[model samples]
Target: MPTPSKISVVTERGQVSIPAQLRKELSLEKGQQLLWEKTGEHEIRVTVLPERKPRGAMAMLGFAKRFRQTRRTEDWMAELREGEK
Candidate 1:
């Protein structure tokens, strides 16, 4: 089934309000960033970029320290490969 389209009027300042239904459906939050691109002479596309989260080695620092390895690497690999036999 085709989804019905929603429309919004552009304001004098060129700002348009995203319809509440679409916003809720898309899970858009305040301060979310969107990318707008012109695909054709009269067509444009809007994409919602995934929310940015703090991610990097720094963010993962000390994460592995919380758990201790109980077995050697070789033992673990052998155990994993045993199922392949």
Candidate 2:
């Protein structure tokens, strides 16, 4: 198969819209991220990073789901106080 190439002009705000055909071919989306790297004096590499889900307050979801807690937070503090004696 042949590679498709095209030219685009950067807007006044330094933003360039990805060509519609390339976007569709690459499955690019509105909120997706693209990493730009300069490989040479005039060459810039565009890398498509994997999609990420922002966890926010639920960052610990599915983490340590099976870990058993041996003691409560208060119980641990009490043990530390006694060990100082």
Best by TM-score: 2
- Reference-based TM-score of each model: 0.60, 0.61
Model 2: per-residue Cα lDDT at residue 44 = 94
Off by over 4 Å in 1: 55-85
> Residue 24's C-alpha lDDT in candidate 2?
86
In the range 1-85, model 1's lDDT, one tens digit per residue, is 5447988899999998998987888899999999999999988899999987678877787788789778899998999899889
Worst 10-residue lDDT window for candidate 1 reads 1-10
Overall lDDT per candidate, in order of appearance? 0.88, 0.88
How does candidate 2 score on lDDT?
A: 0.88
* Residue pairs of candidate 2 with colliding backbone atoms: none
**In candidate 1, residue 48 scores what lDDT?**
97
Number of colliding residue pairs in model 1: 0
Query: In candidate 2, what residue range of length 10 has the lowest lDDT sum?
Result: 57-66
